[model samples]
Target: MEQKRDDTARDAVPAFDWDPRSEEVQADQIAAYDAMRGRCPVALGAQGNWAVFGHADNRAILEDPRSFSNAVSAHLTVPNGMDPPEHGPYRAIVDKYYTPWRMHAFEPTCRRIAHRLVAGLARDTEVDAMAALAEPFANEVQCAFMGWPETLHGPLREWTRKNQAATLRLDRKAMSAIALEFDGYIREQLETRREARTSGAEPPMDATTELLGEQIDGRPLTDEEIVSIVRNWTVGELGTIAASVGILVRFLARHPDVQGDLRARRHDAGLLARASDEILRIDAPLIANRRRTTREVEVGGRIIPAGERVVVLWASANRDEAVFDHADEFRLDRNPADNLLYGEGIHACPGAPLARLELSVLLQELLGATASIEPAGEEPRRAAYPSGGWSTVGVRLA
Candidate 1:
């Protein structure tokens, strides 16, 4: 049967079935999401948004972009926010920047940054992995890759913190302020390039500069479009990259045998990459992605009307017990295609190749630098909504 719809859309929808921001949900996000996955796979959430937790339901939404539109936000999101036909050309542009050749070319610099950060950690002391390792690794590598200034490292760090806080509260005013603040930073880069073009001075030929010259639909990309593309890339570098590092380090720390096994096979990049994906599968580095229903749809036994908001919870779906044999167990034998770590379908993460390279290099460097990495006395503080992984991962590096 097709989805049944009410004449009136959002207002007619029932009140939120679950409170996503309640203290209970924030206490332990994975556990809470798992509970929802079992009890109500397609749950109604605050603000008329529906949270799809089951692997099947989430996969359905991801596979059928027509039914679930990507235009969920009012703000422009470049390729990510645009649905198909329009999404393809822009996606092609993004894809070229992260091709195998490009990643291979940049691998040395990425390795150097990762090595420097890992080597500098104080020995025989407890270090917050988020600070000494995760955040800096992301900050430095992003700057190197984008031809951005090292001075941006601190400002971007603060921006990530502020952005996360504002998002969790769903504070539109603060979120708008945070966004404009980021735009100012990007605008400065654009202005500098414009000056370089006028004065005949050379600006670094990097990703940002390349974007300024990119054409779309036979016309040059607007500053708005360029800024949006860069903003999405920023989230990947600052948010997901840092989160992945903390999660990777903390997971290895908790599983000593796995850490030892990885240390022994450190030179085997493919094996190491598989292990990284498996670890992240158990604990996702990204919590969710939003979608707006394009038509009335039935998902996981729930009938969602057209124009309703929907959220695909990666943290929950990747760990769905139905898909993976031992959902909670970290094992490398599982199929990579089944994992939604880099997502699936056309809107899949474009920076995946770069992400893999950065993480693989970081893993090699991190394992080589440490005699052992073990959890310190304090528990790892989990980051709340809009951010995944630990906010502070405490570990003793010896």
Candidate 2:
């Protein structure tokens, strides 16, 4: 039967079916999303936006960028928030940074950072993995990748916390302020590089400095554009990467059989990579990504009108039982293409190569260095919306 669209759908708002920010939903995001997928796959959220929960629906939205646009925000977001034609040039520049050669060259530095952090983890005692290892690993690796100094690590970590807090509260004012604060950090770095170049003191040819020489449309990228690009990259590294570590460690700590298998295959990069991706698929690190409807569209029996906002729920879709048998089961045999961990389509994460490298190396080092990692006596705290994984992953490393 053909689905009927209401004539007033263009102006009429749909009644919200779920409160995404409610205490109930936030308490157990994965379970709540799972229920939502079954009850209302395309839900009208309390935030006045639609949350697409089904895997097929989410994939369709991601692939059909024309119907669902990426220009969801008014503020400049470089390639991430731009549609095609406009997004292509900036994306080209971003992709160059994460090429095979770059990832291979940066592997030693990444491994070194991971090894140092893993080595410092206390053995046979309860520790908050997020603070003791995950956060620091992400911060140091990100800083090292961009040629940022140790001084920025503390500030960057704190900034990420504030950013997540502001986002959860939907505090636009606070978010704007935090955005400016981060921009200041990037601006200072850009200025320092420019000053060095002008004063005849050679600036380090790091990622930041390399951005200075990048050209688009025959003109050098503007400072604003550069800062936006770096800001996007920094958020990806600091937020999602850290959450992924917590998830990976917690999963390994709980699943002894899988942990034992991965520990044995620590030297096999391919197996380790697939294992990390599979684990993260079971417990997503990034909750959802935003999009706007360019035209009226039907998704999972719901009609989202033109100009409306939609959130693609990665946490929900990746674990949809329809897509994967026993969605929560950690199986290495699952097809990699079906996993939306790094996303799909044109707007897929440009930093996936770098992210995969960091996670794979960190796991190898962590598994190689420790005899065992298991959950502590204390309960783990789940991160709220806009963030995924545990906030305090209480675990004992031995």
Candidate 3:
């Protein structure tokens, strides 16, 4: 039976204080999500926030952007932090860049990069997949998409690492410093492009150039705004891709039979992509995304007052027994029609198509190139963030 809300209970809701940075705490996140889904789907969180776990309730909150605001920070997600009407325009700019044609154009480059990375690992007996393969693969692809030099990969990776640390700290000073560093870099690049234009050289088709061409709210985007958008992508992409690659490889290694089947059905890359979604459903990179409640709303039979923070536990919701049968098992045949890995509604990740394309291509390349993959000696190191996993992954290729 679901718990009912009371005036006394409203004053003090039973909640869990989760320190995402702690390894032990991070390990317990899944268990916490499970327990919350089983008993109190909408419980109070440590920071006095409402945590929503049930699949239906989480979907409701995500879909109803008016009831739960996404505008947590300005200058950083443009409209990822915006709601509905305000979000539409900014999102259009991003959506255009991720159009199927544009992503398809990048496919050859993506596949070449994946093949090169895998080839590099071909000689090594045992490798840290995160560093040797995933990081470089993602960094290079991101650089290619931005039309930036591959030389920027090192600095970009370092900056992403620093930004993740700063975000986890939620420190204003560190964030400001990082912002300045990125701004300086981007401005210098813009100036160089301007100079090159005077020489009659055309700038490359890339996000930076595209953003420079975009008009938001009927005004051209400023350098700071462009930097903020690019910075968000750079900071968010690497870790998740690295973690995802690790998870996929680990999953394949554990189930060679499934790997063989996918390899045998190479013509069904789309099916493989769907199977990848199921893999994500079983071990979602992100545990939860935070939203602010607009007013008093009843979710999972509990009342969340206005001005309260709501943590939508997508990881839990994807595995909710009410929504998925045998939610804990990894089944490649499972349909991902309702998966929440990329989230839902207006704020759903706009770069999802690009990400999916990249992951699909990467897996396809791997299946074609390698005979088999088996676990190496070392255990993988998981990231501290709720959205992160596998700082280091050990794997041996057959």
Candidate 4:
């Protein structure tokens, strides 16, 4: 049944259920979201967006792409921001880059990076995992995967920090500037590749260069489209991947028994991968994705008007008690198809396979290399909205 609320009038604006930026929510999004899910399945947030907290509601919205449009932003976001017929071709192109063959080919490179990072950890000392390992692994692996040079790593890391800050503040001017800044970086790479190919020089055949060759509907993709696609990929790689690392580390440290179990089964690649997904499901890394309602709809007994913004709380939905036996408990045997870690429907994350490979490999290396990973004396700081996981995760590796 729809929870009690007097704002069922056709055009009436629903009262705000929670302040997204309040101290309570910002301090601990997981706990705050879980509480909100129980009280208000479909809530109107202080930011004028409808926050859908129930697993069923979130799933319904995701599956019905026609009603909940992905075109929430004024700017182009490649396939992610496109819908239906428009989203298909680009999505197909993106999917090719993450095929089984591609992931298999990239596994060795991923492992070498993971091995080196784990090897460098200072044993028995408190190290800020975000700084010491998580951020660096995210940066290096993304660069390596994209075939970007080492010099771009520092710039990309700094750019991610600035982008997250601007997003949290809802600074439009800063966001636009940041977008342009990223565009410049990607455009430079494209131009350099174009020049290399033009001069008959051997250009590095990386994802960026390969994208230059992709044709959509018998036409070459525009620079705007290419840049947008690369921007999205980079954001997922650098931001979400890093966040997943911290969340995984924090979970393992807090649950030593689970950690030991994982360490014991580190050789079983399939188990390791499933275990990573389970851990991430318990503490989502990507947070929510946005959509706009095309027409008035009732979600979880709440009337949402036409053209309204909806935020599907992935961080909350994945942990819904109604869906999972024990929402907060990590169980590898749980159904993988039910987990929305990479989301669902056509808009599901295309980069999921690569993310799984990266996280799984890193966990294996970290667990195999160290005898134990425990919490440090320092408290970890949680990342604010628009980012999930810790901003600083201090752990002692022994």
lDDT of each: 0.89, 0.92, 0.78, 0.91
In model 2, which regions exceed 4 Å deviation? 1-14
Give me the runs in candidate 4 sitting further than 4 Å from their true place: 1-14
Q: Candidate 1 lDDT, tens digit per residue, 144-255? A: 8988998998999899888888998889999999999998889899889989999999888999999999999899999999999989998678889999999999999899
lDDT of 3 by residue, 116-147 (tens): 88877853377777788788888888888778
Q: After superposition, how far is residue 30 of candidate 2 from its true place, in Å?
A: 0.2
lDDT of each residue in 27-95, candidate 2, tens digit only: 999999999999999988987989999999999999999999999888889889999989998998999
Candidate 2 clashes between residue pairs 3 or more apart in a chain or in different chains: none
| Per-residue lDDT over 141-162 for candidate 4, one digit per residue giving the tens place of the 0 to 100 score | 9888898898998998899889
- Give model 1 RMSD, 1 decimal: 4.9
TM-score-better candidate, 1 vs 4 = 4
Model 3 has an lDDT value of 0.78
Please give the lDDT score at residue 308 for candidate 4.
99
For TM-score, candidate 2 versus 3, the one ahead is 2
